[model samples]
Target: MNRMPVEPPRIPRRNTGVTPSPPFRDRLMALSTNLRPAAWTRSGIAGGATIALFGWLLACAGAAGGADEVRAGAQDYRLSGEFGLSVHQVGDSIVVRWMTDALVEGSLEVTTGAGDVVHRDATEAWTSHRSAFATPAEDSIQLHYGDADARHRTWIHLAERDPRPVRITGVDSLFVMADIHGEYDQMVGILQNAGLIDEELRWTGGERHLVALGDMMSRGAEVTPVLWFLYRLEREAEASGGRVHIVLGNHEIMVMLSDLRYVHYREMWLATSYGLGYDRMFDPRESILGRWLTEAPAMLQVDDILLAHGGVSSDQLAFTVESHRDTLAAYMAEDLFHRWGDTTAFFDIDSITFNRRVDFFWGDRSVFWYRGYSDSDTLTAELDSVLEHFDSRIHVMGHTPVPGIREVYDGRMILANPLPLGDEILLLVRSEEEGRWRGERFRAEGPPLPLEVGHPEG
Candidate 1:
């Protein structure tokens, strides 16, 4: 009997203003062996009808993951309590805060790197515990809760805000992946296969920078896990001399503005269960991951490549790297934080839209949302203009999902979005001899393949 080929079930994609991904453009691997990462093909694979139906059913069930964890968390907040905490080290004091159902005040035990524990009696400062520790922890910090009968611990630490570089001059090797969209397992698998991270999701890439072109949230069950992984991965990458650059995407902005349309049911249920609407769950002013979102750049240049969520537009060709970072959307973040700047500020989506019409950043042509690069009508000259303005050879962007990894204008533009994990990730390395970054694609448990694999147009 011949085996069957099956396309993955169609999950709804985030609103990109363009036609959404088709119901079954990409097929799936069997649930038994799990993510073998089916090699994408134009011709359908030969298989039995029964197997195809089985694959489709498996794909549909994949989206509802994390049910047990969500249920356990609903029963006891401690199970999911780490997400509610945010730690920031100020001038001489480290400020700690957490989201709680009711006013919470208790003893906050701090454990430093040297194995010393300092006990501080925390006082309620609104909805969560607020404490300013005189000791500065640039590395690991453990927060202890509960009494002798039962002990609970949540480890928290954030490296200094030295990330978000607009331009990086020298870098030999770089790993580029785009539009994670909460596919945490695939993200981990692909990165681990590339030798960028270990099985534990710790960065072992060593001086090798990792670039995420954005859309790290919404659409799947592992949204929180992905964010949290990247959060720690960023810090670990920095400590190992590698930097993790995260470019802002439309879905991330949508979450910040409480536009929760494309988010997975698991995350939505958690927010509702905790009474944290979308914004409060990942609020830019609170939630450690939410705070990191504001610091992420909309676009940046590394060596000869320009990385952006959506490729830059014609008018934006005149915008500088810093200007790209200071779009009105970014301004809205600071303004809203100062004006309302409280936990109660979320829940109101209307007040957070920030005049999307007038702001060029939120406009269709802006960096965070533009999709012109994917259209064949987009002139090569316009792309060349972008290259000349930024003095970069290639534009690496995500937003418009290419079937896999696509190279247009004979390799001047690459669109890698919403990593389906089918085609896996694209790796670009700086070639000192050629004096330009070269591109290649990598799939699950296999050697690197030619860039041509992703470009069927050839």
Candidate 2:
């Protein structure tokens, strides 16, 4: 039921469509924008036992955030269990990629949810096993990677909603979270508060969509565990007849392009230990998750609400949703994975904005990094047309964090950013008691926070 490809696709050197005046490394200081601030401080993962035993890489990843350096020391730390396991849908088959230190055969075993053994195949280390059943797995398929020496396993979610679709409708219940920034334990606690997952982190909220509006990785040292957890959660939720949507965030773009300024030093050390660069951790040629992530979806329409990491900007008002998708696909297809230009180091807007007028995926004006929504006048002026072009009643986005969850422009746009640990989250739920669908300001602990759009009466 499983096969391996000769090699994964390559991520070529990108051409940003702009000529550089000087070497990029030279421009790091003079043309750079302010380094993004680090995430809120968090200490100690409570349930550390379930986290997969992953390893570190060669170089120091980056300094820690919030003004403190990652104290994991300057030593190049390397250990075992750096398997970045992921299950990706590939053409009619499912490919399971598990990172191994060396080539070893007969290391894979797969089982059905009903306890039927489907595949016991020999797998090469550092490569994935592609599972192709005549009739695809309907719900879930449990995979056990590694043989007796060292092993890791999980059940892959396979309800199969198109990760990028034009629209999703008929969803009466959902949870909205933003900017996790690699705080795994805290993110789990937030999910637990809504009864979305059980104590074991298994999805229990049936048919209710949970959307993370982006920035799932970076900032914290536990990015590895967070990545694995979301991978598992997405599948488990899908199997439970629910869905988990990960809108692409600026951080996601940053990490993939070898920009590790905000990535934790521990994370850098972890990747170096595995004999790989921090960016290669998710590079399509190196990891299945990276292969999947490369084809990015800038926006997702869920029922009447549109989800994006950064809200639409004034410049994007003229483009249709399909036009945006086509553009994104074209860029990814051509393997145009360019890093941010020298002029505006941190996305599109440098303090100078010198030679930087980037409108592509990596630019500040692109969907992942735009902050124009923070300006009420500009946002309100263009909000209606943007929503109408996208065919959504509300546009929910994360990137520019507000003091609290915001329902701005008369609820036409919702901002869910800077969502700190135990902070408020926006919710859309079908309230049986009220006989209607409603939105609310929810938190992990304490009573529900008040929201003007609590009852949409839709």
Per-prediction TM-score, please? 0.69, 0.66
Best by TM-score: 1
How many residue pairs clash per model? 5, 12
* Tens digit of per-residue lDDT, candidate 2, span 375-455: 444456677877887777778888765667767677677777633532666787666686444667766676657564321
Candidate with best lDDT: 1
Which residue window of length 10 is worst by lDDT in model 1? 2-11
Candidate 2's displacement at residue 432, Å, is 9.1
Clashing pairs in model 1? 3-47, 4-47, 4-48, 7-27, 8-27
Task: Give the alpha-carbon lDDT of every model.
Answer: 0.62, 0.58
Candidate 1 lDDT tens digits, 1-458: 22222222222234443321223212333343443335432123322232334433332333233456445543443223344444555556666554444444434677866768864555643344556677544466777643222234656655546546779878888777888887777888888888998976678899998888788877656677677678778878889899988888877876665445456555655555445555566776646567677888888898878888887877787678877676633664654433321222322334224333224444677777777777554478888998999988888877776666867777888877633532467788878797877777766578886664333341
- For model 2, state the Cα shift of residue 437 in Å: 5.8
Candidate 2: how large is its RMSD?
12.5
